[model samples]
Target: MLSWKPFALSVAVLLILFPFVYLVLLSLSSEWRFPDLLPSYFGLKNWATILGSEAGLLESFVSSLLISLSVAIVSTTSGFLISRAVFYHPKKNTLTLLAYFPYILAPVVFAACLSFFFLKMGLFGNITGVIVAQFIIAFPYALLFFSSFWNKKIKSYEDLVATLGGNRWQTFIKVLFPLAKGLILICFFQTFLISWFEYGLTSIIGIGKVQTLTIKVFLFIKEANYYYGALSCCLLIFPPVVLLYLNKRYVFKKLV
Candidate 1:
C-alpha cells in the first residue's frame, strides 16, 4: 500500500511555491506577455522604482512596519491578560464567544459599523484610529490563541505559584512568561500579520491618510500597475515568511 503522506507533502509544496514563483516572475519581468513561458528580459527596475524616493513606498513600508509591530505588541499583551481573565471567569464560554465575534465577522462590515463611532470620537482618518480598528480584530484572535495556555497543567502551576507566596504579577513574570514565551511570540506574529495585511479596516478608518503597504498594493492594482503590485506583494510576504521560518526553527524548538 502506498502511503499518502509523500503525495500530500508534494502537493502542499507545489501549492505554496507556485504562487511565489509567479509573483517573483511578475515582479522581475519587464516584457513578459501572455503565452510566454518565461520573460526574455528581467531586471531590478521594478524593485528600484518602488523603493526609490519618489514612490513614497519606503515611507509606506516604514508605516506598515511601525503599525504592525505596535499592533502586535499591544494586541498580544492585552489579549494575553484578557484571555487569563476570560479563562478564570465563570461564564468562560460566553466571554470567549464575545471575543470571537469581532474576529469572525467580515472586517469590512465590522469597520463600516464602527466608522461612524470613530468619526464621532474624532478617531477616523489617522494612524491611531487605524491601530484601534486593527486591534479590535487582532485582539480577539490573540485572546483565542492564548486560551490554549489556560489548561489544567497551567492551573496546577498557578496554584503552585500561589502557594509559594507569589502574586499574579510574579507568577506571570516568573512562571507563565518563561513557560509561554513561544506562544507569546506566535501570538505577536499572528497579530502583526493581521495588522500588516489588513486592508478593509485600515481603508475605512484611515480614509486614505494612513498609507499602509496593503493600501499601497491596492492602489497600484487600482492604477493597473501590475509590476508595482507584484513588488508590493513581495514586500508584504517577505517579513511573514522570514518570521515563520524563525518561528518554526527557533521559537517552536524552544517550546519543546
Candidate 2:
C-alpha cells in the first residue's frame, strides 16, 4: 500500500522553501516579463553588480552591518544593566511600564515626533541620525526583554556576590554577566534583527541619505526593479541567517 505521509512531508517542505527558492531564481535572472514562461537571462550578472560601484549595494550592506551592530551592542548592554537598576528601584513597575511607550506609537508617527529633536541636534538625514532613531526603538525592546532576567533569584545572586566581598563591577564581570551571557547574546540577536529590517524610522530619520540594505531593497522595489530587489533581499537575509546559525550552534546549545 502507498502511504501519503512521505508525499505530504515533501509537499510541506517544498511549500515552506518555495518563496526563498523563487527569490534566488528571481535575483539571478532579468527580463522576466509577462507571457514568458521564464526569464530571458539568468546567471551571476546581477550578483556581480555588488562588486561594482554601479549598484552601491556593497556600501549599503556595510552601512547596515555597522548600524545594526552598534544598535544591538548598545541596546543589549544598556538594557541589561538598566533593567537591573529598575529591578532594585522603588518604582520598578512604573519604570518598566514606561519602556513600553515606544511601542504605543506607530514607527512612522514615532519618527515624525522625534524629527524635531533630530533636526535641532543636527542629526537629520545622516547615518548618525538613523542609528540614533533605530537605537530608540531597539533599546526599549531590550529593556523589556531583560526585565524577566531580574527576579528574587537573581537578587540572591547579587547578595551572595556582595557577601563574598565582590564589588558591583566584580559581581557583573564575575557572576552576573556569565549567568546572563545567553540572554545577552539572544538580546543582541533580537535587537540586531530589529535594526536590520527597520524601514519607517530609517526612512524618516535618514531622509534617504543613509541608505542601509533595507532602504536599498525598498528603493529597488519602488522603482519597479524586481531583479535588484531580489538581489538586495538575498544580501539582507545573509547576516540574519549567519546570526541564526551562530545562535543555534553556540548560544542555543549553551542555553539548552
Candidate 3:
C-alpha cells in the first residue's frame, strides 16, 4: 500500500500538470465544441493552420522570442552586476530602491509609469518601447535573486578575489559571475517568462498592432475563435516552458 504522503504528492503533481496536458490535447484536436465530452478526431490541422495562416501569429511569436531573449540577457547581466555593486556598497540610494520596488508594486502600475514616458517620446506602441518596458520589468527579478545569491554563496569569494590581485571588474568577470552562475540562470528563466507572457504592458505599449502570441491569444479569444485561441495559447506558453527547462538543465547545472 502506498503511503498517503508519497501518494498525495504524486497526485498534486499530476493535478498541476493536467492543464498543460489538456491544452496539448486541445491543440491536437481537429474540431471541438461544448457537450462533446471529448473531441471527435485529432490531427495537426490546428497547429498547421495557425502556422500557415499568414495571420502573423508566427511573426508575433518570433518578435516575442527576440524581445524576451534580449531582455533576459541584458536585464540579468546588468542586474547581476548591479547586485554586486549594491552588495558591496550597501547604501546607494538608487540601487537600494531598485532592489526592493520591483517586487512590491503592481506590474500594471509600473507599466503605466514606463508607458507614459515612452509614449511622450514617440517610443511607445512599438517594438522599441516593448523591449525597453520588458527590460525594466525584468530587471528587479534578476537583481533580487542575485542579491540573495550574493549574500549567501558569492560574497566571500568576491572579497578573496579583491584582496588577492583582482579589481572589482576583473573579479566580477572571473569570480562573481562564475560563483553566481546558478542564480543568474534562475534570473534568466524568470525574466524570460516575465517578458514572454507579459500581455498588458506589451499590448499597452505596442497597442493592437504589435500582437505577440499572448496578445494574439487574447484577440482570438475576444473574437470567439476558441480553437485557434487555444492553439495560440499553447504556442505562447510553451517556448518559455522549453527555455526554462533548458536553463534548469544547462545554465543551472552548477546548482544541481
Candidate 4:
C-alpha cells in the first residue's frame, strides 16, 4: 500500500517553501511576461546589479544593517537594565503595563503622532530618526521580554551577590549578565528583527529620504519592478536567516 503520510509531508514541505523558491527564481529572471512558462532572460545579471549604484540595493542593505544594529544594541541593553529597575519598583506592574502603550497604536499612526516632534528635533528624513523611531517600538518589546526574566530566583541571586560583598556593578558583570546571556542574545535578535522589517515607521519618519531595505522592497513593488523587488527580497531575508542559524546552532544549544 502507498503511504499517504509521506506524500502529505512532501506536499506540505513544498507548499511552505514554494514562495521562497519562486522568489529566488523571480530574482534571477527578467522580462517574464504572460503565458510564458519561463522568463525571457535568465541569468546572474539581476544579481550583479546589486553591486551597481543603479539598483541601490547594496546601499539600502548597508543602511538597514546599521540602523537595525544600532536600535537592537541600544534597546536591548537599556531594556535589560531598566527592566530590572521596573521589576523592583513599587509600581512595577503599572510601569510594565505602560510598556504596552507603543504597541497599542499601529506603527503608521504612532509615526504620525511623533512626526511633528521628529521634524522639530530634525530627526525626520534621517537615519538617526529612523533608528530612534524603531527604538521606541523595539525598546518596549525588549522590556516586556526581559520582564519575565526577573522573577524571585533572579532576585535571590542579587541578594546572594550582595551578601558576598559584591557591588552592583560586580554583581551585574559576574552574575546577572552571564545568567541572562542567552536571553540577552535572543532579545537582541528579536529587537534586530523588529527594526529590520519595520516599514510604516521608517516610511513616515524617514520622509522617503532614508531608504532602508524594507523601504526599497516596497518601492520596487510599487513601481511594478518585480525583478528588482525579488532581488531586494533576497537581500532582505539573508541576515535574519543567518541570525536564525547562529541562534539555533550556538544560542539555542547553550540555552538547552
Best by lDDT: 4
Please give the range of 10 consecutive residues that has the lowest summed lDDT in model 3: 146-155
Q: Please report the TM-score between candidate 1 and the true structure.
A: 0.90
Q: Which segments of candidate 2 are over 4 A away from where they belong? A: 1-6
What lDDT does model 4 reach? 0.94
Error of 3 at 34 (Å): 2.8
Q: What lDDT score belongs to each candidate, Candidate 1 first? A: 0.90, 0.92, 0.79, 0.94
TM-score of each: 0.90, 0.96, 0.86, 0.97
Name model 3 segments beyond 4 Å from true.
Answer: 1-10, 90-98, 152-156, 159-163, 250-253
Model 2 gets an lDDT of 0.92
Superposed Cα deviation of residue 182, candidate 4 (Å): 0.4
- Candidate 3 lDDT, tens digit per residue, 133-240? 888878877777765665644667767887898897898678766766777777888888888888888777887777888888889889887767877888887877
Question: Clashes in candidate 3: how many?
Answer: 0
Top of the candidates by TM-score? 4
Between prediction 2 and prediction 3, the one with superior TM-score is 2
- Across residues 1-256, which tens digit of lDDT does each residue of candidate 1 receive? 9999999999999998999888987888767777988877798888888767766787899999999999999999999888999998899999988888887899989999999999998999988899889988999899999888998899999999999899999999999988888899999989999999899999999999999999999998998878778888888988999999998999888888
- Sort by lDDT, best first: 4, 2, 1, 3
Model 2: number of backbone collisions = 0
Expressed as tens digits, the lDDT of each residue in 37-103 for candidate 4 is 9999999999998899998899999999999999999999999999999988989989988889996
Question: Model 4: residues >4 Å from true position, as ranges?
Answer: 1-3
